[model samples]
Target: MSSYFITGVARGLGFEFVRQLSTNPANTIIGLVRDKTATEKKVSEELSGRKNVHLIQGDMVDYASLKKAVDEIATITGGKLDYVIANAAFLSVWAAFEPFSLLAKEPEKLEKELVDMFTVNVVGNIHLFNLITPLVLKGNGKKIIAISSGLGDQEMAINYELFQNAPYSISKTALDMAVAKFHAEYRKDDVLFMCISPGMVDTGYIDPETALLNDMIGKFMKYAPDFNGPTPIDVAIQRILSVMDKSSVEAGDGGKSLSQFGNKQWL
Candidate 1:
C-alpha cells in the first residue's frame, strides 16, 4: 500500500484527490484542510466507512498548525508517504480583472485585492512547499508532485491562454523553479518530482467571465472530446492516480507533464 500527503482538501481538486485515493484500501491519504469547522464533517459524510482516509485540519498560512497536522499524520502512519502534493493554492478571481488603467480605480480596494492575491496564490504556496519538503524527504516513496498551470511555462507563455492571471501565472512559474531546485538538490536520491498542468478543470473557483472566456477559447486550444470535460475535482484525482500507476510511470523521472485532452505532454 502506498501512502500520500496532500493539502487543500476542503473542496474542488483537493477533495477530489482525497476521494479518488480513498477508494482503494491499500492507498492511505492524509488530507490537510483550512475550514476546520465544516470540511472535516463533510469529508466524513461524503466518505464514510473508509478507514484509509485520515483528515487533518489546518491551512497553509500557519506553519505551526500545519506542522502539527503533519506531525500527527507522520506519527500515526509511521512516515511512509509515497507522494507529497503541494496542492493547496491561494487564488483570487480579482487578479484577472485588472484594467488598462489601475490609476482610475479605488487605490485601496485594488491594493487590498492584489495583496490578497499574492498572499494566497504565491506566498502561501511557497510556505506549503517549504513546510512539506522535509516530510517528503522522510517518506518512503520517490515522488513529489505540485499542481501547476500551463501558463507557468514562461517560454510558452504567449502560446497559452492564461487570461490576465498575473499573480497566478507568475506564482506557478516560481513554483516550477522551486520544484526544479528540489530535483537538483536531491539528484542523488533517486527521487522524481514534477509540476503538472491539469487542464481547464471546472473547479468553480474561477470568475464567471474568466470561465466563459476560457471556454470560448477552449475550442482553439483543442479541448477534450466530451466537451463537458472533467470537473476540477474529478480530473485532479484521476490524474493523480493515473500518474502514480507504475504503468504510467515508464520514465522514472517525473518530469513536467501537461494534460490537455487526457493525454500527457512534456514542456
Candidate 2:
C-alpha cells in the first residue's frame, strides 16, 4: 500500500489531498494539523470512517511537535513513508499588498513578520524533509512534494510588476529552491523532489469580510481580465495530483519547479 503524509490537512488543499489519496484502499494516508480537536468536525464530516486515513496533531512551525508526530507515524506505518507533502504554510497574517509593504518599512515589525513567514514556510518545510527523508528512502515511491505558488516565480513577478504579498512570495521562492537543492542531492538515490504551484485556488482562506480583499482581487484582475477568482480546491487538487502521479526523474520532472499546467510557466 502506498503511504502518504501531508501537513495542514484541516480544511483547504491539504484536506483535499488526504481525502483524494485515501480513496484508494491500497493507500494509507496520514494527515497532520495544528490541533486535532479543532479539526474534529471537518475530519468527521469530510473524512469519516476512512480506514486508510489517520489524523496526527502537529504544527509546521514547531519542529519538536512535527518530530513527535513523525515518530508516531513511523510506528504506525512500519517506518516507511512514500510521499511527504509539505503543504502547511503561514500566509494570512501579512498578506495584503500595500499594508504588508508599509509594515515592512518598520524595522522591528518587519523582522518579526519575515521571521515568522520564513520559519513556517521555508525552514519548517526543509526540516520536515530532514526528518522524513529516511522514511521516504525506505518506501517504494520516494517523492517529496513542496506546495509552492506561482507568485514565487521571479520572472513572472517582474513581468507582472507584482509586489504585493511580498512576504509569502519571498518565502515560497526560498522553498522552491530548497526543494530543487534536495532533488540535486537525493536524485541519485531515486528519491524525487519536486515543487508544484496549485495556481489560484479558492480554499476560503481569504476573508470576504476584509475590505482589502476586493482591492487585491481588483489588482489581480488587471493582468488577466478573465481572472474571475480562485478555482475550487478539489478541482485544483485533482489536477495537481495528476501531475504528481506522472512525475519522475526520467521524465525530467525531478528537481523541477512545475506549475499547475505541468510546465515551467509557474501557473
Candidate 3:
C-alpha cells in the first residue's frame, strides 16, 4: 500500500490530490493543513466514505508545527512515507498583477511580501522535506513532489515578458532550486524529487473580467495562443499524479522541473 502525505488540503490542488489518491482503497492519504477541524469537516462532507483519508494540523511557516506533523505522520504510517506533495505556498494578491517596477515603489511592502513568500514557499518546504525525509527513506516509494508554477520558468519569463507576480515567481524559482538540491542529495538513496508546474488550474482565483487578469492572459496568449485558460483542478491533479507515477530516479526524472505533461511545456 502506498502512503501519501500532502500539505494544504483545506482546498484547491491539495484537496484534489487527496480526493484522487483516496479513490484507491489501498492508498493511505494523510493531509496536512493548518486547521484540522475545518479540513476534517471538508473531508466528511465531500469525501465522507473514504476511510483511507486522514488529516493533521500543521502550518508551513511554523517549524515546530511541521516537526509535530512529522511525528504524528510517523505514528500514522508506521514510520514510513511513500510520497510527499509540498503544495502549500504563499501567494500575494497585492503583488499578483504588478511588475517589479511598480512593486519597487513601495520598498517596505515589497520587502515584507518577498520575505513572507520566501519564508513559506522556499524555507518552509525545505524544513518539511528535511523533517520528513527519514520516513521517506524507510519507505518503498520515496518520492517528493513540489508544486511549482510556470512563472518560475526563466525562459518563459524572458521570452514572453511575463512580468506580473514578481515575488511569487521569484519564490517559486527558489523552490524549484530547493527541490533540485534535495534531489541531488537523495537520488543516491533512490529518492525521486521533482518540481512540477500544474499549468494554469482554475481554482476560482482568476476573474476573467478583471483588467489585470486580462493583461496577463494577453501575455499568455502571445506564448500559446491556443491556451483557452486554466484547466480544471481535478484534471490538473490527475495529470500531475500521472506524471509523478511515471517519474523515477532511475528514469532520470530526479531534480527535474516538469510540467503536468511531464516536460517544460507549461501551457
Candidate 4:
C-alpha cells in the first residue's frame, strides 16, 4: 500500500480531498486538520466504515504539534511515504484592512501582515515538509507537492489587479521560492517538487447568495478565474493523487514544477 499525507483538512478544499481519499479503495491517506475535536468528529462520522483513512490532529501555526503528527504518521505508515502534500494555507493573502489597502500606507501593517502570511503559507509548509521528508526518504519514493496561488506569480500578477494582494502574493511567491530551493536541496534524494494553483476554487470561503452578490461575483471572477471555473475540490484531489502515483524520481531528482491544472508552464 502507498502512503500519502495532507494538511488543512478542516473544511473547504481540504475536506474534499479527505473525502475522496477516504472513499477510494486504492490509497492509504493520512489527513491532518487543526481542530482535533471538530475535525475528528466530522471525520469519524464520515469514515466510520472506511478502513483506508487515518485522521490526525495538527495546527499549522504550531511546529511542535506538526512534528508530533509527523512522528505518528511515520510510525503508523511504517515510514513508506510515496507523496507528501503541503496543502494548508491562509484563507486569503491580504491581512491588514486599513492604512495599507493593498495600495500603500503603513510600516506596522506591512510587517505584521507579511510576517503572518509567510508564517502560515511559507513557514507552515516548510516546517511540515522538514518533518515529513525523512519518513519519505526512509520509505520507497520521494515527492512533495504544495497548493500554490496565482497571487504568487510575478508574471501573472503583473497583469491582474485582483491578485495584487500585498502579503498574500508575497507569501505565495515565497512558497514558490521555497519549492525551488527544496528541489535543489533534495535533488540528490530524488524528490519531485510539485505545486498546484487549484484554479480559483470556491471552497465556500464567502457566501455567494449574500447581498452585493453581483459585485462580489465580479471581483472573485476577475481575481481568480478558477473561482468561476471552480473545479470541485474532489476532482483536483484525484488528479493530484494520480500525479503522485505516476511521477518518478531517482535519487537526486529535479525539474518537477507544476501548477493547479497540471500545467508545467505555470510554474
- Which residue pairs in candidate 1 collide? 90-120
Winner on lDDT between 1 and 4 is 4
For lDDT, candidate 2 versus 3, the one ahead is 3
lDDT of 2 by residue, 1-267 (tens): 799999999878998998899889889999899889867777778778788888899888888998998898899899998988889998754554655557757869777777888999999998889998999999988999999988888886776667767878899999999999999999899998999889888787676677766765665677567777888888899988988989998788888888877986543
Model with the higher lDDT, candidate 2 or 4: 2
Cα deviation at 44, candidate 4, in Å, is: 2.6
Against the hidden true structure, what lDDT does model 2 obtain?
0.84
TM-score of each: 0.80, 0.92, 0.98, 0.82
Q: Arrange candidates by lDDT, descending.
A: 3, 2, 4, 1
Query: Per-residue alpha-carbon lDDT of model 1 for 1-267, expressed as tens digits?
Result: 788888888887888888888888998888887776687688778998888878788767676887788678778678646787777877656555444165236677656755665566556666665666676676777677777776565544455433455556677777777667766766566556667666657788655565545543464244334545434557556765575454223364445544433234421
In angstroms, the error of model 3 at 40 is: 1.0
Q: Cα RMSD (Å) per model?
A: 3.8, 2.0, 0.8, 3.7
Q: Give lDDT tens digits, candidate 3, residues 1-267.
A: 899999989999999999999999999999999888988898999999999999999999999999999999999999999999999888778999988899999999999999999999999999999999999999988999999999999999999889999899999999999999999999899999999889998887666678889888888888888999889999999899999999999999999999999999899
Q: What pairs collide in candidate 3?
A: none
Output the TM-score of candidate 2: 0.92
Please identify which of the two predictions, 1 or 3, would achieve the higher TM-score against the true structure: 3
Q: Name the best candidate (by TM-score).
A: 3
- The superposed Cα distance between candidate 2 and the true structure at residue 107, in angstroms, equals 3.3
Q: By TM-score, rank the candidates, best first.
A: 3, 2, 4, 1
**Candidate with better lDDT, 1 vs 3:** 3
- What TM-score, to 2 decimals, does candidate 3 have? 0.98
